[model samples]
Target chain A: MQIPKPYLLFLGDVRDALAVKMARGILTWRPEACVGQLRLDDQTPSLGIDDLPLEAGRERGAQTLVVGTANAGGKLPEHWVDTLEQAIELGYNVASGMHQRLAAIPRLADAAKRQGVKLFDIRHDAPALEVGNGKRRSGRRVLSVGLDCAVGKMFSALALEAELKSRGEKADFRATGQSGILIQGEGIAVDAVVADFISGAAEYISPANDADHWDLVEGQGSLFHPSYAGVSLGLLHGAQPDFLVMCHELGRPHVRHLPHIQLPSYAACVERNLANARTTNPDVVLAGFSINTSNVDEAQARAHLAEIEAEFGVPATDPVRFGVGPLIDHLIERTR
Target chain B: MQIPKPYLLFLGDVRDALAVKMARGILTWRPEACVGQLRLDDQTPSLGIDDLPLEAGRERGAQTLVVGTANAGGKLPEHWVDTLEQAIELGYNVASGMHQRLAAIPRLADAAKRQGVKLFDIRHDAPALEVGNGKRRSGRRVLSVGLDCAVGKMFSALALEAELKSRGEKADFRATGQSGILIQGEGIAVDAVVADFISGAAEYISPANDADHWDLVEGQGSLFHPSYAGVSLGLLHGAQPDFLVMCHELGRPHVRHLPHIQLPSYAACVERNLANARTTNPDVVLAGFSINTSNVDEAQARAHLAEIEAEFGVPATDPVRFGVGPLIDHLIERTR
Candidate 1:
C-alpha cells in the first residue's frame, strides 16, 4: 500500500480523552509521515508534530489532514465542522477514522470536491467477507496480542514491520481497527465486523503469499477484556499466528471502559491468549512482549520491562520508547 | 404483530431443503395463519395446508401468499420470480423470509406496487443494537439452547410460546433467524449481526416487561459448534435467561457444515451452555429439551425422546410431532 503524508488535525480540545486516539496512533506509528498537528486547543502546549502550524504543514506539502481521533460512535463532533471545512478548502485531503463518512457531510465534502482533494473515510466501505475456514496459511505470521484494548497492538506490529522492511525483509502489517486503517491504507475494523464474519475479516487480511515473508497482523482488544473478548478470539483464530508478541500498556490496572474488571497478570494474559490461539492452531507460541511505556518515564518503563521479563521469562520492549527489536529478532531467528 | 394469512408459495421443487424450512415453521408455529401451499413440485403429496390449491386459498379469503421458503443468501431465484409475479397479479400481498429483500427485486417490487399490494421483506430492517452487558433480566426467560445449528431451536421456542398462549399465559416467541422472521411478523437475524453486537441484539429482543410474562427466546448456533461458538457465547451472555430449553436433532452424529467435528454428548452440551449462561445469570436452569425427530419414524422418535428424558432427567418432546406441552408445563410450573 502506498503511504500518504498527512497533516494531523485534532479539532477538539487536545487535552480531552477522545481527541488523542488517532493523534497518538499517527504520532507513534508513522511520525515521519505526519507533517504537523493543528493546535485547535491553544491552552495545552504543542508537543512533537504540533510544533508546526497548519500553514507550515501546507508549505511542507502535506496532502491530507488525518483527523486525529477514533472517537466513540465515530461521529464527527458538530463544533469541529468549521475546522474540517477550513482544512478541505485549503486543498488538503481529509482522512477520517469515524464510522460516519467525511464524504457524507455536506460542507466538508463540498469543500473537498471544489478543492480537488480526496476524503478517505477509513472505517466505511470494508468489503463483506465470508466465514473463515481455519486452513493452514502459507506464510510466517506474528500477531501482536494485547493485554487490553488500545494497548499499542497496531504500533508494535507496525514497528516490527518497519524494522523488517529496513532489514530488507518482505513484511506486511495488517491493520485491524480504525487507527491502523488510517496508518496502513488497508484493513477491516474487525470489531465493526458482524459476529459471524470477524474471523473471516482476520483471515482475509492475514493471507500468506510466501513462506519466507512475514505478515505482522495487528490485533484488537484482549482475551481478558470482557466486552471485547469475542473480537480478540476471532482475530486470534483468524490470524492463526505461529508466533505472538504480547502488547501491553505499562501500568494499566484494569480494562478501559470497564473499570470494575481488573487486568490479568502478564503471565495470565499470555497464557489465555496462547490457549485461545492454540485452539485453532495448536503449534502457536509467544515470541516476546511489546510493552507500552508511553505512560511511564524512561527509568520506570525500563525497570517495569525488566520486571515483566523476569516474571514471564520473555523479552519485552516498548516499540516507541525503545523498539520491538528483541521481539522482531526473536521472530526472525525462530519463524523465518 | 398482526398475522397475515397467505398462500404458501415454494416455486422450487418441494423436496428442496429451503422449501420445507418456512413451510414447517409456519405449519408448526402459526398453522391458522397459513392458507395453503402452492405445489410447484407435482410428484410429492401436500400435507396440512398444502391440500388446498392457490385458487382454494384465494377463495377462502387469504390476503397474502407468504413465500414459504427462506432460501440461503436471501436471493429470489430467477424462476421463482414468475410465480411471485403471478401471486402479485392475483391481488395478493407477498411475504418473503430471504435475507435479500423482496422489495429490492425489480419485477416483483414493480408488480406488487402496481397491484397495490404490500411486499414484506421480513429480514431486511433489523435495527442496530449495542453490546450486551448481561444484566439481570426482569421477566421469566426460557431460551431454546440448541445442540447444533439448524436443530430446530426456533421451532421449539415458537411451539412453546403457542402452548403457553393456549394455556392462557402471556408469552412471546422472539425469532432469531430468517425462517423465524417469516413464521413470526418480526425478528433480527442474529447471525447477520456483528460479533460485538450479537449479544446486544439478543438483549434488545428479549425484553423484560412483566414478571408474570415469559419470553421464549429462540437460540442460534451451539456452544459446542466450533465455527459458531462466539455467536453462541454472545447470545447466551445477552439473554441472561432464567431457564434454558435444550434443542437437539436426533440421529445427527456431527455438526452441520463441519463434518470432521463430532458432536458433543448431551451432558457436555448442557453443561457448557449452562456454564456460559450462568456467566450472565447465576440462577439459570435447564428447563427441558426440544428434540427434532424429523429424521426418524414415530416409534423411534418416541423411544429416543424417552431415552433422552430418562438419561438427562429432563422432559423431552418434538415440538412439531408431539407438541411442546411437556416442556411448556415444566417451565410454567418451575418459573411461574
Candidate 2:
C-alpha cells in the first residue's frame, strides 16, 4: 500500500527508544518524507526533528500522520485516540505500524471517513494477491536472508539500495515488514498475510523491472528459525533472487525467543537458503555476507569480516558499522 | 474445530467426481461418521451412501451438514443457500470446505443463529495460536511430506494412522487441510491460517501426548512448490515429527499448476525436507516413501516401490493400491 507522505511521525508518550524504531527508521532513511515529529507529551522521546503540533505539521505539507511508535502490547493506546481523531479531522491520512488497526477504533474511523482521509494499517493492509506463480520475472533481485530474526536484514537491504543508487545503478528497496513499509511508504507485511499468500505477496512487492534494475528485498525470519522459517522460504521463492546476501548477527547464542534452539552455522544457513531459492531461480548465487558486528569492537569486527571473506571467498562487512559498498561491488561484479 | 458427527454430506449439483473429492474422502476414511448423503440434483455424483433429506438425516443422528463439494470458483452457489438454511433450521450445524465463508451468507447465517446451530467454514476456522516455540514435546510423531501439491500427503498420513491403529498402537491422524479436517472432524487448515501462525496452529493441532502415542500429522504443499513452500516449512517446524514419510506421485512431470517449473528429484526433496525438519526435531529421519501409483499398473507400481526401497534403504509402498504395512513395520522397527 502506498502511504501518503510527507509524514508527521506520531510518538505517543513512548519512553523507550525501541518503541520508536519505526519513526527512527523513517527519519534516518527517508528524512525528506518526514515533515515533523508529533508527540503526546514532553516525556516522549524525540526523533531530533521539530516537535510540531498537528496543525503546524499539516501546514508544513504533512499529508499523513504516522503512528510509528509501538506500545507495550502493540495496541493503540486509548488515550491517544483524541489526537488521532484530531489529525484525521485536519485532512491528514493516518498510518500506523501497530498490531491493532487504526480503522478498528470508531472515533478515528468515523473522523477519517468524514474528512475523506485514509487509515493505513501497515501490518494489516495488503492488496489481494495470487499464489506465487514461480514465473521468472525480468529483474535482478538481491535478498538478505538471516541465520535468525532481527539480524539487520532490513538495514542491510536499505544499505544495498543506497549503495546501488550512489553508483548510479537502478535499485529499489522492497520492504516486507512494518518498519520497512513505513520507511519506503509501500510494501506488504508478508508475515501478517494469510499463510498461503506469503510468496504471492513477496512477488507483488518486487515485480518485474528493467533487467539491469535491482530490487533489494528485505528478508524476515531465518530458515533455521522454527517459528518463522515458512515466511522466510515463501519470500525467498517469490523474490526469486538472482543474488543472495546472508545476514548474521555476531555472537548470537541461540535462536530468538526459543532459548533451547541454537543458531545454525553460517555454511548451513547459506546452503539451505540457496537450495530453496534455486526452486524459482536456478542461476541464483550467493553474493556476499552482511554481518551485524555491534557486539564486537572495530578491530574484532574487521578481523571477523576478513576471516569470513577468506573462508567463504565472498566480501563480508557490517552494513551499519561500515557500509554495503563491498557487497554491492560483489553483486555488480557477479552480475557482469 | 470439532465438527459434530455424524455428517450428512452435501453434494450440490456437481457432476464432476473431482468436485466431490472431499465428500469421498470423508466417506472412505470415516464411514461411521457419514450418516448419509444429500444431493441437490440427481446429476450430482453419489458416495454410495443413503440419499436422505435434511430432516431425515438429522433424525438419523446427523449433527452436521457438511458442504463437501467444490464449484468452479469455490464459491457457495447462490442456489445452494436454501438447502444450507434448511439444514440449519433442522438443527444441523453447517460445515463447508469452500473458499467462501458459510457465515457470510445472510440467509444461512441468520438461519443458523436463529436455530442455535454453528456454521463452520473448515478452511477459515482456526484457534488463536502463539508463535511456535520449537520446544521438544512428548509423543512420537510421523508426518507425510510431499514432492508437490496433491501428491497424496494426507492419504499417506491417514494410511499410516490406520495401519498403526490396526497393530493396536496408539495413533491419531492430525489434519492440516480442508478434506483432512472433514475426515478427522477436527484440525486447523494450516494453509488458510495467518502466515505468522502456521506453525503455531500446527503445534496446537498435535499437542503433547503419551510417549508411545503417534500423532500422524498430515502435511500440505511441497517445500519445492513455489506457491506453497512456506506453508510446508511452517507445518514441518510445528509438527516436529520424529519420523517423516515422503509422498510422491509417479509420472508427474512438473510441479502442479506451474508446468514451467520442473519437480525436484526424489533425493533432493527428501534431503531438503529432512534438513528443514531438523530445525525443530533434530533427530527426525525418513521412515518410508508413500507413492501414488494410480497412473501405473500393479506390476509397475510394485517394481517402482521395490526400486525406491532399495535405493533409499527405507520402506516404500503405495498406501492406497497396496497396504502401508511395510512402512508401518519400518516405523515400528526404527522406533524400537
- Model 2 chain B lDDT-worst window of ten: B70-79
What local distance difference test score does each model get?
0.76, 0.92
Candidate 2 versus truth, CA RMSD in Å, comes to 1.0
What is candidate 1's lDDT per residue for B1-336, written digit by digit as tens?
233654454545446554566666667667776766776667543554555555676787777777776456657777777877887888878877676778888898899889998887755556767776655768888898887888888877877887889999999988877777767766777777766777788888888779888888888877655466666667777777888998888888777876655677788778777755665677898888888889999999999889888988889998889888888778777864
Chain A TM-scores in order: 0.81, 0.98
Scored against the native two-chain complex, candidate 2 gets a DockQ of 0.92
Minimal lDDT window, size 10, model 1 chain A: A1-10
Q: Score every model by TM-score.
A: 0.79, 0.99
* Residues A139-236, model 1: lDDT tens digits: 88889888788887887889889999998999999998877877776788888777787778888888867988899899887765546666777788
Best by lDDT: 2
- Candidate 2 CAPRI assessment class: high
Interface C-alpha RMSD after superposing true interface residues, each candidate, one decimal: 2.6, 0.5
